[model samples]
Target: MNLPSLRATERFANQMILDACRGAKRVHIVDYGILYGDQWPSLIKALSERAEGPPLLKITGIDFPSLVNLEKTGNRLVDYAKSCGMHLEFHSIATAAWESAQPRYHLFSELLFVNCQLRMRHIREDGIIDSPRKLFLEKILSFKPVMFFQSVVHADIGSPFFIHRFDGAWRSFLARLESFEETMKLELIDQSQLDFMDKFIEKCAMGAIACDGQNRVERISSYKTWDRLARKGQFGQLPVSKRALEMVMSVWSGHENFTYGMDENWLLLGWKDVVLNALSVWEPIEKLPRFKHQ
Candidate 1:
């Protein structure tokens, strides 16, 4: 099974809520697509362990009805809650967001990571899921917590970022929430935060070494800026995760611009910005496993 994300929207949101659990009697978590609900247990553990608390904890996990691993994921969520001494309940929707969407609140931890959404790009207008997410928040603004953590993608491999272009579907989704009369304090993720997978960086360095003794090293970038390989010591000294960037770069080659270099979180609809960031890959890692080669 894949490990949960330390940098995921869920985990990040929890981090923001680690404090200020006062008056919070319950927590709500919405997994629009509950892929095994695998992240919930760890998140619960983190919440249970991270901050000092009072007032019993109640966690409600809501998911799409058709998930195959619903039973397993729900069981894990329950077990984790019991072990952590938190109250737990599970709810599911037989329909999809496409079919219909209902505002959901699942848990009440000190950490608040609400605007968790998949992203997409539209040419005529911008598509920001957070826009609708704000609506969701407006509905719950009365219970206003301290911090809200959100993660969104600014770049992707193709013309549309939604894994495919979304036809104002996001705007339509957000429109559903706009009827709320109030709004909550909001913040967006800056560009510098999520730039690379440690593994992707390592792969880049590996590819550099594999490139040859004389190949010219062009640029190195993570999620932000791109720079050229410094010297003989640069790639060789980078950690395996850093070198893994080479593979991600290779993958970027297929993209209009390596979004990783352009700062993986930058809005990608502009014409002027093409190449993302440059990841310096030519170094060597000692005894590191090699990523797939091109």
Candidate 2:
């Protein structure tokens, strides 16, 4: 997460989360793919540190059954939050597929936030009603979060055909960067950074020539498709102001090698089309359910 672009994305999301829980006693955040659980500490700190903010914060981190240590991670976070005088009800839920887990909506209350970062790529699985995209809409509409935050990688590669054919300008740009040895110098980059850059190049090259048309693992669609889905789900997009975009880009301001962009939907993506990370916050078109008032 040392990548400036990535750090910017996380910062953007953190602000959005804070805004959503501005003045509340309780907040529940459902993180679809809680990968490494790295983003929560900062968020927890923010909530606890806020002088006048939500009094209680509850996070329900959900992921596939493969994340064996999820509860252990959640407990650690819980302990950390408690030490800081914040009540963090951390729960780790393991399920086969989050889309199919829509029936689990009863687990969360109305003061909720849905954080779906880089997890949309797995939302489609070859069916009509059971499609990942359809289920994603259904999942959010179920609880109708006060705020919805989503960020995806290479969101423009919606289809294998599009992945096969890169824009003329983009292809040339990648070619130029790949040949530049400066990016791989140990003094300038770490093994992790080198690994990320190498794999990204390999994916683009392989995607261009690989004959298997239906094997795209991260089946992602463009932001346009996501916009359409959001509207269909009766959600309204909140603009990420110029100031926010500027903040997101601030990290890369002096870095000459990186390029940053904000799509029409105000989603942020970096490094041309290769490393796409768009972030958008949405509010429910209608009031969502809340726990019964005393």
Candidate 3:
């Protein structure tokens, strides 16, 4: 997500962390799927800018080794921390699933935060938790985070909840793509830019649509389902205030294209109104392996 889209998320996350850490000297945040490091600068800057913030902000990033360059990303974060006057220590653990990986306890503090964004869907793509996904969540909750900041692209195609709305959503995405294409044509965009847009349309816009015989299903579930999984794993949603929601939506309110909607407890965002289904995958309950919260 872009910085504007994530402004409210960062605020909510920082508030939760501060509230949870109340009297703590330090805060430890565990970030899952730290892809290319676009998500952190704003959050880190916000926390450091907080006058009442903890003395130390330690973040542990977890992802597959082959997918991320740990040392390189860690160095970039360390540099930002140093400039911001926060005692920043970053540790990168190479693991595909948290269930199988181990995080050194010495890095943790009294307050723990788990950050997951747009990446958990892959874990439930098969409609089952299987072993790794369950274990991954189980291990994180083992740290007993004060709050888990999870931002899934909600698109619950599994339920009739969005049955009637799917068409509108599809149209919106298509319109956005068409508008962009027209703009490109007007500007006579280069071949590379055209290529990028093609990829975005294929992977993002089109990939979100689920029809018969299509392998790319919108695996995102509703907030209710997520609540069930969170409850199973021993975490709960952070209650967000009305003002906060408005503030988050305020940035996009005047925008002509992008749309946002609310359902159950999920606040959905997209290029248009096509969020009838959750964008992430769901896990099948019957197939979930027994996991007693650690």
Candidate number achieving the greatest TM-score relative to the actual structure = 2
Model 2 misplacement above 4 A: 102-110, 160-189, 196-215, 241-243, 272-275, 289-294
Write candidate 2's Cα lDDT for 1-294 as tens digits: 455545666777777767656666677788878866777888888788887854677777878777557788788888888887778877777885676664233434436778877667666646666776777677777776777887764434454454433453255436434533343462377767777776775664454334233554445556667777788878888888565666677665544555655565656555533545567878788855544310
> Model 3 over residues 1-294: C-alpha lDDT tens digits?
233444545554555554445445666778787756666776677667666664576778887777779778888988987788777888888775556666555323335667776566545334355655566677766665556677764544433334543653456446546545654655568778867876775665444454423354434454456666766876544455565565566654544655666655556666554542221211222221212211
Q: Give the C-alpha miss distance for residue 251 in model 2, angstroms.
A: 2.4
List TM-scores for all candidates, in order.
0.40, 0.78, 0.70
The C-alpha stretches of model 1 lying farther than 4 A from their native spots are 1-8, 20-23, 50-55, 60-62, 69-71, 103-149, 156-294
Residue 249 shift from truth in candidate 2, angstroms: 2.8
lDDT ranking, best first: 2, 3, 1
Model 2: worst 10 consecutive residues (lDDT sum): 175-184
Query: Candidate 1, overall lDDT?
Result: 0.34
lDDT of each: 0.34, 0.65, 0.58
Q: Report clash pairs, candidate 2.
A: 123-132
